[model samples]
Target: MPAQSWKLISHFWGLKAPHFESQFVIVASSFSSFLYLGACYGYFAKRERNKIGKIQS
Candidate 1:
């Protein structure tokens, strides 16, 4: 939403400019999904480790 960000995105994409609303939504959704996936992975990995530890014990 900042002037510098718009310039960077336009330069990177080789476009005049990106639609602010659409880009914001896309970025927000992508970030949220990444966080969700990380959380899920961490939860499963911890559970698996605990299970293995129990088996070893």
Candidate 2:
């Protein structure tokens, strides 16, 4: 995932050297998107597991 994002970021840099701010924004946004997804998955999984344990008990 990191490699893929780096590839995208590098590609943006290579193609748009003149638009430095835009490239940074793209990279930051892409990275944050991944981080948010990971956090969401973790929260959901933990909540589901807790529910299952309570039901089993």
User: lDDT (CA) for every model shown?
Assistant: 0.69, 0.79
Question: What is candidate 2's lDDT per residue for 1-57, written digit by digit as tens?
Answer: 456776677677758776776677667777787898889999999999999999999
What CA root-mean-square deviation does each model show from the true structure? 7.2, 3.8
lDDT leader: 2
- What would the per-residue lDDT of candidate 1 be over residues 13-56, giving only the tens digit for each residue? 54444678557755765566678888999999999999999999
- Model 1: pairs clashing at backbone N, Cα or C within 3 Å: none
Model 1 scores what on Cα lDDT? 0.69
User: What is the TM-score of each predicted model, taking all chains together?
Assistant: 0.64, 0.55
